[model samples]
Target: MTSGSEFPFSPDPVLSGTSDDRQHALQLNPQQLLDRIPVTIWQANDQGQIISLSARWQLITGRAPVDSLGEEFWNSVLLEDRDLSLQQWINACQQQRPFVLHLHLCSIRGNSCPFLIQSEPLLNDTDQLIGWVGTLQSTDVVIPLQSKWDYTQKFLQALLDNLSNGIVACDTQGVLTLFNSSAKKLHGLPLCPIPADEWASYYHLYQADGTTPLPQAEIPLYRALQGESVHNAEIVVKPSQGKPRTILASGDPIIAQDGQKLGAVVAIQDITLRKQAELELRKSEERWQLALQGTGDGLFDWNIVTNEVFMSPQLKQTLGYADHEVDNNFEGWRQLVHPDDLGEVAAAIEAHLRQSMPLYVAEYRMRCKDGSYKWNLARGQTKWDDNGQPIRMIGSHQDITRRKQAEMELARLNRDLEARVTSRTTQLEVAKNQKEALVVKEQEARRQSEVDRAGIKLYESIISNIQLGILVWHSQNLESVDHLELVSTNPAAESILKMNLHVEIGRQMSDIFPSFVGKHPDILLSLVEIIRTQQPRSIENVPYTFPEGDENLFSLRAFPLPEDCVGVAFENVTCKETNEPAFS
Candidate 1:
């Protein structure tokens, strides 16, 4: 028995045994040994004829070892590599050395198996090659490599065909190697005779700002070729005759398995819409500024969380503060508010925030730099977030100090005028009451005079006993003289004078009759005569008439009473003639 280590070559136990045993193993052949070795092995002669094959080769090729022995073996080789393989085998046989080959072997299952073959020339002692001994190893592990290669080719073709964005692949030298369908479509070119590095210059791509052509240094593809990965790099490209195009580009370095840089893959997408939107936003901001300038109201915006205030220039001017003097914060406003009005101002702001309504009016005193406080009418509205929390406030402030002062002055004037009117009304009311009292007193005094005059006439009638009328007069020159009451008398005056004789007896003449001069001219002359002579006088057959239209003949005698009142007694001459005619 020979151990494997004792043999220089691993010899088959059956082959090395005695002649009888060898003959027995030769009948079994290398085909049986190959199948037992778990690998398929075969040998072909110098003329590309199969000399022998293991059982696995027969099983894989679906042919017997004897059937594979001649030109039939060459026919069994895959047709694509058969001719080349045959030449290589002949060369190795001529050199009388070992050679290696990789070939696709067809299997009965219609699948192909890859194998590595190592062959050594079999030589006699005379140095002449007799046959070849080859060993075959199954290469099933290489199946994955072939599968990956097929999938990569399909994946790249699909990627280039279906991509929406422009894709270009270039070698490290900037020579265009691959251009996708989108890249062709973007430049309005066909895929035939795809453009190379000349495309870079022929397109004449410039930046959107019209500054310059896209420099290789700034291009994502160029950066990737320089061994850098670029992501979302923005670039603008302008053609020679059209509007500029904005693109967001990305690139990555393509490297071989051995870390050798091959080229770069670049992806570019149009971004013109995004840039246009940004430009519109800037214009909108400008319009907002213009609007604020047009309106006269002082505008302000305040952030609640930050407590910062943004005021337009007009707002600062309205507050009587220099632009720099007004601090851009709520604290500045709070400090400027009059101490007395601070609470009210705070309440108004809080109410607006809580109610989420516009505060149309709030009046407060704002201290100016000159140390004077002016009234300001502030109106504000709270801006709310989606959750109804107050986030910002916008408002206007108006200076109303002049108007407020005018209103206050008007109120004061009104109060003063009301007081004056009340005072004048009191004086007028007192004067009116006093005048009424004087008029009442005058009426009563006149009534008393009539009573006194009647009394005087009655006294004269009783004492004289002569159906006489008495007329009393006031002495004009004497301030203390009694005045007359009787304005006129007739024959019927005797009875009327008798009624008030007692009351008129010793009264002052002017006291008894205040209107004597206005009533009679004759009585006034009689009173003057009596007062001048200081004597009694009589008049006979004087005609007198009463206010009632009755006539009488009277003898008048006038005498002075106390206080210079005249007592005038008139006797009816008709009765006197009747009574004293016989005696005459």
Candidate 2:
């Protein structure tokens, strides 16, 4: 019509714009418009294949537009949400409405990039769906940053809650930022927020010497804030209700990315048991050294695995070796032992090892460098590992040569003395037996003599009652008349005897009977002859007269006694004036 300049509907009708203007107002170049938008925009067909994408979509995916325009573009969605994003886009196109989905999208580098996608249907003038258009914006950092921060905070709190050792952190302004359960207990305070000014009242740190508060430079946590790590620093914390307690503290600094100091983390441990053990060990070593010195004994430690021996200085001196001269090995020790004692020494050691008992003790000779052997008394004990296997041995050695020599000499002297005593005792016993035998013989002889004397007295008494004069004389010496006395006489002889017969014990017969000595010399001779012959003799019908009486007839009888003695008896006969011999 414009070309023809002819139109039935003309400007007279309510027409203000031309048809070209109307067509221009209703048309848009989707690609060019999408490229101008800030959000990522895309169009997909009913089959969910990408038809077009904005320049921003290519920039975020780092892909060319041609490579990204396909159903495969949905592969860029995270595997966990790909199907859901596709289904949502399809439903929105069918329903002819806008739909929103939150999905993780992957780029060309396979990194997850979160996005919020809002999709709406594109329709034709007949209201039939053509495709879907969508816009995507990255919400990776914004959507979950707060939740992540909250989770991190809770995890840190749990860690602090479960810690056993005290933990504390402070800011550069000396403000308490974090305190753990253990820290509250250590400081003897409730788990309430502490003002900065009151921090010193709850937690007081002291130097190891305990004489004064720790200088700021030496405090572990303070040092840590200055970018230093402290380990095993002693500290003392004064509690509100109790005395101060000792602790070992360690700390390190927490730094930010810009190397700025954030705060410090500190840990404390109680070391009272360790300190007491150290003190006790020192005392034990001192006592051991003193005891070894006092006893003049040397200590030795031996390691079985290494075959090495450690000897005290006293041992070197005792062995007559310089302090460093003696070797510390089994062979070295064996070489120093005397040849004669080596067997016994080795046996003792073998027995100890085999038995796994407490100790082994023995005395043996050890060769000195000067070619002399000295006796040594050694005692050793085996030490075992936890599994009951021997690992080491410790022992003592002492010089006993002088003592041993003295003991040997004393033993020899004792043996000699004992032998001498035994010999003397035997000799004395023999002499005693001989003396006793002699005494017994003497007693027997005395007993026999007593019996003979008793018999002689009885015989003399019997002969004297025979009314005769009796005499006894020694056989070997008849004249000596060892025992002769008047026994009895008739009334005539009692008057003629002229001597007191009762009192004449050792008197000779001649002295007591002197009248017979002259007139009866023959009778005395006969008595002597009978004693010498050990025979009986008699004289009968012999005439005799007394000096003061009438004439009388006398008869004599004599007999030899046993063991050289003689007995004699005499009888007197007189008539009564008629021719009758007197028989009285």
In candidate 2, how many Å is residue 160 off?
3.9
Q: Global CA lDDT of candidate 2, please?
A: 0.65
Evaluate all candidate structures by whole-model CA lDDT and list the values in order: 0.63, 0.65
Q: Candidate 2: where is the Cα deviation over 4 Å?
A: 1-152, 161-164, 184-201, 238-245, 300-313, 321-356, 360-394, 399-584
Write model 2 residue lDDT over 285-357, tens digit each, in one string.
5445433432346677777868988777677788788868888777777787888888888888878877644
lDDT of 1 at 563: 47
- Taking all chains together, each candidate's TM-score versus the true structure is 0.34, 0.35
Instruction: For candidate 1, write residues 1-584 as lDDT tens digits.
Output: 01111111334646666899778776764334445666655555545455666666666778675676666766657776575555555544655667776667676777766767788776678886666777776667545587776689799888777988988776544555566887665544432222233444565545556467666576677778788899998776665555667787789999999997767888988787789977996775444553453355566778897999877777677667787998889988788889999888888888888884466358999887788888877877887777988888877776666556655655564565566665687665655565455455545554554554455455445444534455645444543323434433334344743334345544544455444334555656656667666666665566555555666565666665444545566556655645332112
Model 1 misplaced stretches (Cα beyond 4 Å): 1-169, 173-204, 228-233, 238-244, 250-259, 265-270, 287-293, 300-310, 324-397, 400-584
Tell me the deviation in Å of residue 408 in model 2.
16
User: For all the candidates, what are their Cα RMSDs to the real structure?
Assistant: 48.5, 50.2
| Number of the predicted model whose TM-score against the real structure is largest | 2
